[model samples]
Target: MKKKILYWGILSAAVLVVIAASYATWNRLDPNYTCARCHEISTACAKWEQSVHADVTCTDCHGTALESFNSMSEKLNMVYKHFTTKKTFEDIHLTEKQSLALANRCAECHQAEQASWMSGAHSTTYKDIFMDVEHNKMERPYWDCFRCHGMFYDGDIDDLMAMEGGPEDWHIKDASQMDKPAITCLACHQVHHEQPRGMNYKDMDETSRGALAQKAKYPSTALYMRADKRHMPADKLLKEQIFAGDSLVAEIKDANTLLCMQCHAPGTNHQLGSEDDKTTIGDFKDMSCITCHDPHSNQLKTSHRNVHKKLFSTLSK
Candidate 1:
């Protein structure tokens, strides 16, 4: 009995020691700090530090399963790869799966925005875009479709589709991924974008109020450009010209509306109403797209059935 007790005690002590070692190691290699250790990611860390999400930890967004055995194992694997491999950090980017996972995390804070986006056409799924019978019947799905639709998809159009450029008798290679979102929160917004400083709000005049309102309205509203695979500020992007029937009708001046144009505009063909294009013409030539359509909800006030009735009623008076 005495010998058995001694063995049990020894085993218990060993287990405790192992647990303590692991806890200590995990704390020392905290995901937030561990990410900063890489020289290549230092710039990203610096930008994050200046953004609104400076308080948020790297693990909060990047972690797969927090405080779980799998999470710890993943961290360990990353650490091991960092030390053993020379190309561990080369072209490091969040995968489509990772981006989708991170969208849920973003919803925790921006519930209203998430709900609005999810309710709108922008939150369309892979199946909705790729497997639409009517759309496929009219136009065959191609690699160029992914430039706007499935920008974050890991594989090329060839990898996803078994047959291309044909009579629409096709299916996605990964049927399991059909329901997954083709575009997510990260598709349009840059979470780590920092707001500009040095605004003179001292005067409190009408001009000052206007400037402040404009600044507050568009605090770090950035559009993710698929071509560059990077977030570009809306103001810088809106400077580009938009056409309507061979004429440069809309030189997008409003930064807020520019974000919408990124996806809504014409494709490489540059033709109006081509490939999901919604270029404005006629009387709506100079108007911003967001003038009648709510950006998040996509509700068109002018096009509503009752809009004409309301206008006629007002005019009759």
Candidate 2:
């Protein structure tokens, strides 16, 4: 019995030592050292500092592996593993896993953007558009947070362009992570303590700027459908307008359509409007989405609430 107890005690001691060593090494291992040194890329350190993203440390986003960090040899092995991994149908080949990891990291700083984005009309439609239920048959999954937002390192282009081809399903194929560069966090946030322009809707005035703002927010939906020159359901709406020559709505609407409708064109249902009222805006056909909702600070506050059009209803008629 004493012999068995002695043997059990020896095993327990060995396990404790391993645990202590692992914890100590983990606490001491530094991610900047592992990633920057083994990769021999000073930009990882340099850009990281200069970027507004400098506020976040490497490990904060990348998720640390202390065992690998404790040994320079192990760290180098991990780098090799990442480069050597095979491609998959998921996102860009070496990216999907790391992308997922970085998304959790990004949430640390972008919780507010995430909340608003979740509530926005864009997010709601993206789920259906990307899923392709009728065609994919395979029921391909949609991109989660990282597919669009995460940063692609400089050399990852080759991995992205290699995916399968089809216009509707092509972005699904591999893309050079390098080509799909991440718009920096500061692209959306005021990270350097700069005061933001605030809600665009709240800033409108009766001056030219506000008039231009009107043109920007509510662009001509009918003229855009007609100008597509492609056959569409909304083309007839443009014909119903009161002008035989160039209608003022058509002229103004076309200009604003060129700017806002570049991506938000007529064919796709933006899901903001109904079948009858969706494209109808009377004289304000020459506007864009940014007119009503400030791209930067449009929250559901009374300050951002729009009342300009309601006040001008008589003139609109």
Candidate 3:
């Protein structure tokens, strides 16, 4: 009887694994098709389709498979179950904290972007700003991947479904505006199977271009972003436009200014070249914000000072 019971338990566990895997697979497939239909304004999605990541599917970076979804409790309950069930951290089945893993995975397709991200802050030792405690309190903390990847949709479903494309569209002058939740892996990197036909767009020009050219030896995939901090109540400005509310990791910006603000904000302690000395105004203006922060993990810490240093420097600058 005990052997029979053990066999039945093994069968049950196998079934659950299949169910979970199937659920995740389906969830990952559905969003790309749904998002592509609505985001017609920019050719970005069209470009994404050509990228190597086109085959990866969304769930590869984002988490997956709840019987019920888009509920706050989905994430909360999973987190609770992991803690109470006596599973070791390694035994914990999670799709989060896999940025490095995702980078490694993306390397299978997008070698260039993988190379770029690895050389940058995302793969570095400092805790991800999104996961860290120090930097997340600023005005627009929850904008990008910092909130959505591990955690399911905790905000209004209506708002999420309404949006048409990822935050990447926010910077383009002609990009469309729709209420789209974060959807695809290609949303960030232009993954290409064959080498892209032409020269990729870059910011380097004659005068300041020299340093950027030198830095390009390291080759970074991050984009340039800046918040037009010349606006009103700094906190309120961030809340309405970027953050969902109090949670900094929940930073959401459908606007590029918020993206830019991730680095450009007053009192931002970024240095032009030196680690010890922070950048001055002339130096700050010359450098673009995208040089450091990952758009997805905007709230996640990549640099040493955390968001506080970025925020403080924004004010001071």
Best prediction by lDDT:
1
The lDDT values for all models are: 0.67, 0.39, 0.37
* 1 versus 3: better TM-score goes to: 1
The TM-score of candidate 2 is 0.38
Displacement of the residue 178 alpha carbon in candidate 2, Å: 26
For candidate 1, list the clashing residue pairs, or say none: none
Q: How far is candidate 1 from the true structure (C-alpha RMSD, Å)?
A: 6.6
TM-score result, candidate 1:
0.73
Of the two candidates 1 and 3, the one with more favorable lDDT, higher being better, is 1
Cα lDDT of model 1 by residue, 63-123, tens digit = 5433678667766876686777664333456667667878988888667667878888878
**Ten consecutive residues with minimal summed lDDT in candidate 2?**
224-233
Candidate achieving the largest TM-score: 1
lDDT value for model 3? 0.37
- In model 2, state the lDDT of residue 317: 55
